[model samples]
Target: MVEQVDILVVGGGVNGVGIARDAAGRGLSVWLCERDDLAAHTSSASTKLIHGGLRYLEQFEFALVGKALAEREVLLRAAPHIIWPLRFVLPHQPHLRPAWMIRLGLFLYDHLGRGRRTLPGSRRVRFGKHVTGEPLRADFSVGFVYSDAWVQDARLVVLNAMDAARRGVHIETHTRCVSARRDGEGWTAELESRDGSRHFVKARALVNAAGPWAASFLDDVAHVKHQHSLRLIKGSHIVVPKIFEHRYAYIFQQPDRRIVFAIPYERDFTLIGTTDVEYKDDPSHPTITAEETSYLCDAANRYFKKQLTPDDVVWSYSGVRPLLQDEAGSASEVTRDYLLDIDQNGPPLLNVFGGKLTTYRKLSEEAVDKLAPLLGNHQPAWTADARPLPGGGERDIDELLADVRATRPWLPETFAWRLVHSYGTRARDLLGEADGLNALGEHFGADLYQAEVDYLVRHEWATEAEDILWRRSKLGLRVTPPDVQRLTDYLSTKR
Candidate 1:
């Protein structure tokens, strides 16, 4: 039997989840399928920022920069828990991009966005005055400070999915769309979930919002032939112990003209990343090589006071950026902007190629708007300046912390801060009626409360322990081997 729906979204990445949320909110019966866990792919493995790409301006991608900048504030308000304002210090070097040019880029970055709030505008910083410059070499006497927002990329995707589900969308995790065939006036698709259950669904319209798998999904549609290509470029990031003093991040210019980000991750570690190289391997299995690790470490050592080795790495991950090939010479130069191709002839398939975490919401809105005419009906775009996600409750962080302390004064100040960072306004929901630390239940070591673990499994669709330990929260770093085994064994019993 085939279950019918108004719309079907392929792939479970950020773009697909964002589109699903938008379509479902508009009162459409939306069904979404992912072959793996939500954000088990590239969506989770990002440098984890929601800022306008400052480096894009060097490529003269003003329009893209402008769109990303505008979305920054929207996202911050939408998910303030996970997305918070961050300062970046670009240390000046003589051989790198000229200072005047860098200043010009910052100028455009500051003015491009529409609604700007707590984020401070760009300004010059004296190397000696600011702590951010402490880790820099002696010769680097100047720098510029600018604003951006950090995001929990995995949570962002999960929150979008959760919101979509709340709005009556049927989300099938661990499910893959095996086949799609044209029916009388719609399409019939078969989905096979991980539980060995096969289900069929019919939809009026299909969206190939599959990130790296867009092309393959397109091929599944009979008679919808096109020559559009996406270049799969793999980017990797490494997490190491904190190497800098200040909260501000660093954007270092490499000799090859590539820029790398050294951002403060969590509170104890630093997240340095992202090398853009052509990937010919499977998108699902993109792995970081020895060379890639060395490259990133080398880049970090070049600009910082201390030289880092691979031994310092505590965690690492890699993801493929599905880039629309526009004939760029270098992978680093490929457009971070997205492209949409709507097939009106054979059947409706909106193919999304190339997008960033910062731009997913806007991209989804545009995609839904494009589909409105094709579906023979339309709804006004609503995600603009809209809230996403869970955890980003309306209450300000200060008040929320004060309230938590009022209720549970025995809770460690540091742990309370962690709760605020993780759950934002929803911290109370996670903590519940707990009066003290012990009431929070079993601790899997280092702030890993039983309540949080349960919340993740029940709400966030976390089936595995690693999802809780590593991706959803970085408690895995602090938890011991026996503690990890305990959590792992407990989750196995649940399944």
Candidate 2:
């Protein structure tokens, strides 16, 4: 028997999963497929920020910034465990940008989209009086502080997929939509699974939320023609040993007018990123260039009292952004806004172009709001005020940690903290009836044990060690090689 759905969404990135979740909530039968693991590419490689893009103000992207600013709180409310408030310290550089300009940007950031009500407002801090300033160079005395939120990027993608599944959306990971064609009144597509098997799917409407592969998916897979094109821009980041002891993150302005962010990551390291370079290669396996490594190091060196080099980098990653093509002078100047163009010449077809992770919910809401009416389904737009993601029920992670400890006092203090922040209230579900650390089963490494692995595989679609280590959790940073091999062997048995 051939399978069918109301909407068939391709690509399992943030935008793809977000769209699937929204469509499913609106009472639509949806099916989403990804060639690889969810968030295997660009979505997982983000700078991991839920910000208003403070730099975009120079580009006069007020509308985009406002749109993103509004979603910050909405996402925070939905997933407080993975999304929490973070303050940024920007050391003043009178030569690069004046104080008044920075203040104006902060003011607009504060007021735009009613950005800061729950989080603290922006303020100026003196290095002499503030603890955050002590790590900076002596010459750097004062700077501005602002509010933004951090996200567990890959987990955000998975949570959306999980929510969609709960609402009856069929999710197929490690499955590729090899061919899609408009057939009869709807669309017929072929999906190929990982073990060399094929399945046919029919859908009333097709959605192309393929991220960097969006343009190519239209050209090659669907064999559809359109005027839209994507300019692939590569952004890279470097992780080094902890640069600062505080919880505060820093956004540095470079001489070239672009910015670099050094954020606290995995509790033991500083995550510094993101050099934007023009890219024309395959987007699947983008690696950080040596020059980008130096650029990020130099960018950080200019602000901090401590100096760093390429050797200091413990790990690095890169993602190719499919920014909508425009007549911009440089890659940095290209707009980060997204476009949704629905082709209705044959069956109703929706193609999602460039978008940032910050505005994915709004993008999904708008995408479905446009596509739903065409399919004779006028379910009111939901998800904005809807239920929270799987583990997001508890807003106070500290309290959740306290509660988990109260019940499972045998669990290490640090171990309990990791579980609560990673899985929220569902941490208890992962714990099951385990009474002690040994009962959680064989230890893979660090605090990771068999019970957590089983829960991830059964619930979160983790099929491999890398999926658990890198994407599902950043435990890759702490686990040893022998332990990873042990995990790989164990997962092989489960598969």
Candidate 3:
């Protein structure tokens, strides 16, 4: 049987799923397919920040910075559980950048975006009196404090997919769009699942939101020709033991003028990244090179009193950014802004190019605004004023945590906190009628239990151990090898 829909969205990254959610909300029949797990590649690998690019101000990218800053507040309000305010401490290095220049950049960041009501603005801090100073080198007597937000990057993608499914969008993960043919007034796409089962769908419009494969998918899979090109820039990050006990994150500026972040991760580790190297290899399997690892370690060592080496790195990840190709001298200088190219010569086709995580919501809204009108649908733009994503209704997460502990007194403090932060109000759904920890089922190391795993598999499209451990939650850091094997065995039986 050939299914029909108003739109066929290729790719399951933030941009793709965000577009699907917007289109579905407008009463359009939407079908989205991904060649791999949602956020298996680029989306999962990020510095995990939601902020206006403060450094981009050096390049005079005021508009992009302003747009991102505005979206930061919207996202914080929309997903308070997964997104929260974070303060960044930038150590003073007069040789790299003058103090006046740094202050000017931060001032613009604080005032550029219009609706900056919630988060506190940037300020200067005396390291000798600040907690962030205790971990810094002695030379760093003065630093700057700025406000940003942290996000569970992978969970954001899953939430968008979940919301799209609720709005009648069909989401197919681990399913590849083998070929797409433009028929008279629509597209007939051949989709292949992991087991080699084939299915067909016809749609009025086609959307290519494939992140790194945006250009390749057009030439090889869809067999369409376009002039757009993507510059694949590989960024790598190394995770090591926590460098400091403070809650504040550090943004270090290297001599090369590129910035690297050392953010607290998984409650026990520090995430240091990322080196910008032009990549020509397969985007699916990007690994952190030894040189890149050394670079990150050295970058962190420059700022923190606790020095690091390559051996200290417990885990590392890399992602290829499909940035828009501009005539930039260095890969790091490439613009983080996005472009939406729409072809109206025949059946409408929209191609999303060169976007950052901070601006994905606006990018998706713009993509739908352009493509939705062409499909004979005049649904007004939404998603800005819409209700929060699933499990994101509660604004005060600390209060929610208090309530969870008050009600489920048997649940450990750590376990209850993780639940409220990860699943928000839906944590109640996972607990169900369970009265104690035993009812939560078998333990899988750390605070992970079978009940949580079941909820993820049933709701969040978690398939493999990595998806559940690294992406869905950072339990991989605490789980032993045998525990992971047990999880794999359990998933196999369920399959």
Top candidate, metric lDDT: 2
Tens digit per residue, CA lDDT, model 3, 257-357: 99999998878899998889999999999999999998999899898889999999999999999999999989999999999999887899999999999
Please state every model's RMSD to the true fold in angstroms: 1.7, 0.9, 0.9
Clashes of 3: 0
Q: Is candidate 1 or 3 superior in TM-score? A: 3
Candidate 3: minimum summed lDDT over ten consecutive residues — where? 113-122
Ten-residue region with minimum lDDT total, candidate 1: 216-225
lDDT of all predictions:
0.85, 0.93, 0.92
Q: Model 1, range 101-169, lDDT digits (tens) per residue?
A: 988888988998656656789999998988887898787899899999988888889889888999998
Tens digits of per-residue lDDT for model 2, 384-478? 88878999997788888999999998999888988888899999999989999889999999999999999999988899999999999888888
Off by over 4 Å in 1: 116-118, 220-224
Clashes of each: 0, 0, 0
After superposition, candidate 2 runs with Cα above 4 Å error: none
Residue 329 lDDT in model 2? 90
